[model samples]
Target: MEEFTIINENNEFKKGKVISVFNISNSNREIVLFSSEDFDSENANLQIAYLNIDADGYNYISQIDDEKVLKEAMYIVKDMIEVINNG
Candidate 1:
């Protein structure tokens, strides 16, 4: 499993598993899906981040603040993984 460190709105870093990676062909963008399981709270939080690749090929997730977009990305990631697994 791939691991990722995500920064929340408060600028706190949270470590999670990289559940999925999505490529946006039209825009040349990559979206990463993260699943942060909080065992203490018995909750699983989903986070969506944009993978920004520099000219030299170094990449990182950009900061995001839209909840709606994050939720949509989570759905997209789940669907994508489901399709891949089913096929």
Candidate 2:
């Protein structure tokens, strides 16, 4: 797994790890699976999110959106994963 810190357009930061990646059928897009930790919570449970990535960039299929932030996070996660797998 690769650690990452993704910041939204509102400047909110989410620290997590790239748990996995899924390819979408009939499309040139991929889903970057992530698991974030909520440190403020008592239990510190893991939060999961799926970010979509294409040629243009990344975006989440939700009302809270920021393509630029998602794109940067995806690139970082992808690079880290590739390095680890190749090594």
Give Cα distance to truth, residue 2, candidate 1, Å. Answer: 3.2
Residue pairs that clash (backbone atoms under 3 angstroms), model 2: none
Q: What tens digits encode model 1's per-residue C-alpha lDDT throughout 1-87?
A: 377665667775666787667864433557877776653466678767787778897766775456666666666777887889998
List per-prediction Cα lDDT, in the order shown.
0.69, 0.54
- Pick by lDDT: which candidate is best? 1
- Each prediction's total of clashing residue pairs, residues at least 3 apart in sequence or on different chains, is 0, 0
C-alpha displacement of 52 in model 1, angstroms?
1.8
Residues 1-87 of candidate 2 have per-residue lDDT tens digits of 377665656776666666675543433445556665544563332333445545776455322144654555556666767899998
* Total clashes in model 2, counting residue pairs 3 or more apart in sequence or in different chains: 0
The C-alpha local distance difference test score for the whole of candidate 2 amounts to 0.54
Error of 2 at 15 (Å): 0.6
Error of 1 at 80 (Å): 2.2
Q: What does the lDDT read for residue 57 in candidate 1?
A: 77
